[model samples]
Target: MGVFSFDDEFTANVAPARLFKAFVLDADNLFPKIAPQAAKSAETVEGNGGPGTVKKLTFPDGKYVKQKLDAVDLDNLSYSHSLIEGDVLSAELEKISHQTKFVASPDGGAIIKVNTKFYTIGDAPINEEKAKEGKEKAVGLFKLVEGYLVANPDAYN
Candidate 1:
């Protein structure tokens, strides 16, 4: 299988700790509350809510994704996971992995970095456009969460 990787970063006015707590640490409880259109529910389906644990996220459209937690470093505000199942996985792909880090900027906001890797089944070429589209969705979700945090200052603190 061939692997294609991509990197993405975005800045937000919300604090890094808050973003990490809401978006990464408490995603199952926060995502559905922040963006109901994007997520219907999220739950840990296997193991516990730690490294190697599996989480199932159901979308409003009835589609879903199974994410396996890889590493989570609270001190560094970083985490990584691999997508193992559900609609997000295409037939041509083996799995998709992501590493995300949230850093506090000088202004006390956040600078979020994400590295995504696509594992293809064979010589199948990755479609750049589709990859970009997926990234856009992720960015949108982040923005939605950012907006929620900005509006509710007491949240995720």
Candidate 2:
């Protein structure tokens, strides 16, 4: 097995707490409502949405993903999860994990950091194009939510 990892960072005009609230804490409710092109719906399948909680996201193509929460730190404005089942993993990947952190910037905004790890099966190397595509999707989602909060300042406040 080979593990390929990467990290990405983005800045937003929204505060960490508000972004965190809308992005992490209330994602199941806020996500599908805004990202119809990505996911048709989202729901908690098990646990109380804390550590070990499993969240299922059904995509518009009728495919779905099941991710288990590894950690949720409200005070620190961070969360971690792994794609345990569904689309990606059942393909060429052995596992995929993600960690997201949000910190306050000097400009009263938020700086978001994302770390991703892709485990490939056997000697199969991680596909760079697919990895880049995944990163693009992640950034797109972040920007989508950021745009939503920017359009409605009262949201997640």
Candidate 3:
């Protein structure tokens, strides 16, 4: 399998604690509500989002993906997820999964970094179109979270 990397970083206007809590801790509940068209819903299938937990995401188009919580350290401000099954995009490249980290900026905002590794089979190569789609998805994540915070400033408390 060939591995392709996608990296994205953004500085959000919200505080680190706020973005982390809203985006990471409560994402299972928050994201679906905010962007129903993209994500139909998400739920805690097992455990409480700590290491060893699992979350299931249902796409609007009826596709589903299972995520295994690889590591989560609140103090370190990082968490990672590996694809367990259900979606070919993740199932095919199970080893190269998704990870996100948050770091507190000295200026009171937060730096959010997200990375995903895509895997493709055979010599045909992972289509560049798919890679472009992945990049757009990363950007959409930030926009989704930011939109939520903008609409409901007091949320995630």
| Worst 10 contiguous positions by lDDT, candidate 2 | 86-95
**What C-alpha lDDT do the candidate models reach, one value each?**
0.92, 0.89, 0.76
Question: Root-mean-square deviation of each candidate, in angstroms?
Answer: 0.9, 1.2, 2.6
**Tens-place lDDT digits, model 1, residues 17-57:** 99999899888888898789999999889987889999999
As a whole number from 0 to 100, the lDDT of residue 12 in candidate 3 is 77
- Looking at model 1, report the run of 10 residues with the lowest lDDT sum: 125-134
lDDT of 3 by residue, 88-153 (tens): 363334444778888877787778888987655643356667567866886788778977886788
lDDT, residue 31, model 1: 82
Pairs with backbone N, CA or C atoms under 3 Å apart (clashes), candidate 2: none
Query: What TM-score quantifies how close candidate 3 is to the native fold?
Result: 0.81
> What is the alpha-carbon lDDT of model 1 when measured against the actual structure?
0.92
Top TM-score hit: 1
Shift in Å, residue 108, candidate 2? 1.5
Model 1, runs deviating above 4 Å = none
